[model samples]
Target: MIAQIGDRLVLEGTHLGDARRIGIVVAVAHADGTPPYEVRWLDTGRTSLIFPGAEARIENRHPDETSEPAR
Candidate 1:
């Protein structure tokens, strides 16, 4: 999936009782907003480069948005 910087990447849990992971897209590897994003995770305050899998989804950020949903 495509994503922009500041967009949130959500990786749904792979198994029962597992928690989803959320991260902000800090950098994009391609000019066309393609995959291989550099993300800073919310939980542990760590950054990683990721090629998102099937369970991942993007929550785009809009300029007019006031705030993000509760984590």
Candidate 2:
């Protein structure tokens, strides 16, 4: 998947009862916005370089005024 800095990377759990993990993309390895992103996780406050898996999805950044309402 393609992502930009500041976009949220959400990794859904593979098993039942596992919590979803969320992180912000701090750096992008490719100019075209491909994987190997440097992400800072919200839960652990740690950074990691990730080539995202099938369970991962991107949430693009948006202005406060233009953002959708929380579900």
Candidate 3:
């Protein structure tokens, strides 16, 4: 994912009936938009650094828009 600061990261649950996890990217660790992103979770308002797996997707935030991911 070509994520930047303010982009939302949505982690789709692997198991059946599991809930998805959503968060905003607060910091980007590298210039190429690789992993080890610092994200702030929507549900708990907590922050964490993550290296995403196959279950994750990125929601880009346009320069002129404000976006919020689904809970």
For 1-71, candidate 3 gives per-residue lDDT tens digits of 67899998999999999999999999999999988999999989999999999999998887886666566
Q: Over all chains combined, what TM-score does candidate 2 have?
A: 0.86
**Using TM-score as the measure, what is the rank order of every candidate, best first?**
1, 3, 2
Give the winner by TM-score: 1
How well does model 3 score by local distance difference test?
A: 0.90
Cα distance off (Å), candidate 1, residue 66: 8.4
Write down the TM-score of every candidate. 0.88, 0.86, 0.86
Model 1 local distance difference test score: 0.92
What's the true lDDT of residue 50 in model 1? Answer: 98
Model 2, which residues run further than 4 Å from truth? 63-71
Residue lDDT tens for model 2, 1-71: 99988889999999999999999898999999999999988888899999999999999988563432243
Q: Pick the candidate with the highest lDDT.
A: 1
lDDT (Cα atoms) of all candidates against the true structure: 0.92, 0.89, 0.90
Task: Name the 10 consecutive residues with the lowest summed lDDT in model 2.
Answer: 62-71
lDDT (0-100) at residue 25 of candidate 1?
Answer: 91
Better TM-score candidate (1, 2):
1
